[model samples]
Target: MQDEGIGSNEVHDIISAMDEHFNPRDLKVGQDVQMHFEPGADEGSYQLTDMRIELNPLKTLTVSRTDDGFKSNLEEKEVKEVIQAQKAVIKSSLYGSAAKAGIPKTVVSDAIKIYSQNVDFQRDVQSGDTLEVMYETHQTEDGYIAKTGNVLFAQLTLSGRKIPLYRYETADGSVDYYGRDGQSTKKTLMKTPIDGARMSSGFGMRRHPVLGYGKMHKGIDFAASTGTPIYAAGDGVVQRAGRFSSFGNYVRIRHRSDLDTAYAHMSRIASDVRPGTRVKQGQVIGYVGTTGRSTGPHLHYEIMVGGKQVNPRGVNLPVGQQLAGRDLKKFKAVVGEVDSQYAAKSGAAVKVAQRQVESQDDIN
Candidate 1:
């Protein structure tokens, strides 16, 4: 090696009795070489750090100075426009369902809005909570997401409360809310075309939240939270699913005998169960998301029955089982007396009201 004049900063490669190899360049300050090698031509050891080999991409390897060790701070989400760039990955993935189910892209956008209405979602949702949604999607001939889809189930899990809402039917030709236990949660049919809280924004009315111009609210707004689950307010099938720059993700559910419902602003949906599948009461259909014409997350629950608009709260739900003899008597007495007391008091805001007062009034 000395005869070859390989300097301290240089390296040597040879094919000989030892099949030996020498290091390249002087070891840097505080730097050392680690090696792996084969036995030499006769019996000497071969050194690895001195040799070059094809790179192995699968192996985990690192080379660094002592001044700093590896430090990794990686966030969970990414921003990619294409489908493959999806950052929110899940075991029970929702986008896959939209594709397979033939839901329109717009419907999904609406669903996100619907989900966002749950106030708690924006402030208190935990990492491990589950969001199970069932929605529909339309596809291109190539099986790509052509449009958004309608949500059949949108269930969100929080600390302890599980809000199970449904799109169900009564034995008598009417569709309305039903608890998962098959019990009715509805006091009556939504008098208007939409449900949830009082109209945050009204129909046929206009006032741009941003610009000073006035625009029609078209439908009503129901306050909720980001990531909150939205339900189909009645038994129906998805009519449209697509994205509208203004609407964001949206879904329209068409019901039997000329009834329909619309949900807007959603994050995503469940991977299984599509447009035509029948959904029962209290089904988790979609999650609230902010994607449309307004601020913050909330549901825009709209209903259209008989082609005319009406407040969802005032709509007559028909009557449930007609509270028979004993139950009927008890029910009427109880209900009537309370109404009478309220009518009598009218404006009594003294201390506070008590359930007993109402009960006693009913008994009388």
Candidate 2:
């Protein structure tokens, strides 16, 4: 190769222009070659600060772009407005009654309290009852009753179709339960023996435990957890009990007249339980378990009348005691107020309803 003998000034300028390009003449004919160059200001090249990369302000969900420089799935949300839903007002009215137009009291009372455990209108009711209720709805963010409230005016119907009501004040007030005809359901004892407790098994069935064979189950089985207390099925005095072979850990009670009941297969009997002990209905008699000749855990219950076992869970299961005359009238009045409560937009009340859900981050 011939030396060009270029000017010293030209050589100096070339080295200054490209500092990293040292071996520049290593090219061969028809050979592959690669070269990297740093952009310069003089040759329309830009520094990093001068170069611009356009970016969209919105978030994109598409991995591949379309021909139009936009993805098919990129949705643009329009910012309109958000309206806070208002709740309907809560009002107190007749829930049920035997008077004219009304549902059964027991069924309605059971239905109303289901929402909030704390309700005051439960008291003051009789078997043959009637009621009348009056109350106003409130205004709330989601509406009024949508917010949740107590009884406004409770009108309890009595035996003679008399209605007595206790008004519920909105501004932090005490709740009072009363009956129509100026009567009260709040007595020393409740009418129903069992309230929330569920019956695991009923009297009369086909099952065996000791021999592991199918046999006639004479009594009912209340399958509660081990250590769960068993209540006396009725008001009775403890009779024959203690430890029996087949009826392992039993408690027999003699009730009024010719009625009697027995609880067996108990893990343990209460210390208070003994012969001649007077027990009330719903009182703890024993704990449920797989004692005696039992296959699994259960409460063996039996109800005897005139010294004979009968179906305790018969459809005609007896109520604690039915009230009549003035007592019945007062109960119906309370039911009246509970029935009208549905007027407060709880879904069936409104023609159109929308449920709103907000994330914690969004709400704040």
TM-score of each: 0.35, 0.39
Write model 2 residue lDDT over 1-364, tens digit each, in one string: 0123334653344434323322224323543322223454468552211111111222122212223321223322233222111221223343423212322343234223321111223343444554333334333333323212334343334345544333322123423333333332222122223233345555555655466667777776755667777766556689966898888899988865677778888888888998889886556777877778776667777777788887764523232333456545555665565445534423432344322223444676
Candidate 1 steric clashes? 78
Error in Å for residue 282 of model 2 = 2.9
Please list the C-alpha lDDT of all candidates, in the order they appear.
0.44, 0.47
Residue 94 in model 1: lDDT: 37
Tens digits of lDDT, candidate 1, 1-364: 3333333332322212112221223324444323334454456544232322212221112221122321212122222222111111112333444334333434434433334333223334554444433444444433454444344334445555565434343334444323344444433322322222334665666777766688756566766667766665544566766565777777766656666666677664433325665543234557677787657676666666776655544444432223345543444454454334433432332222456588789999
Report the Cα lDDT for candidate 2.
Answer: 0.47
- Model 1 score (lDDT): 0.44
All predictions: root-mean-square deviation over Cα? 21.1, 21.7
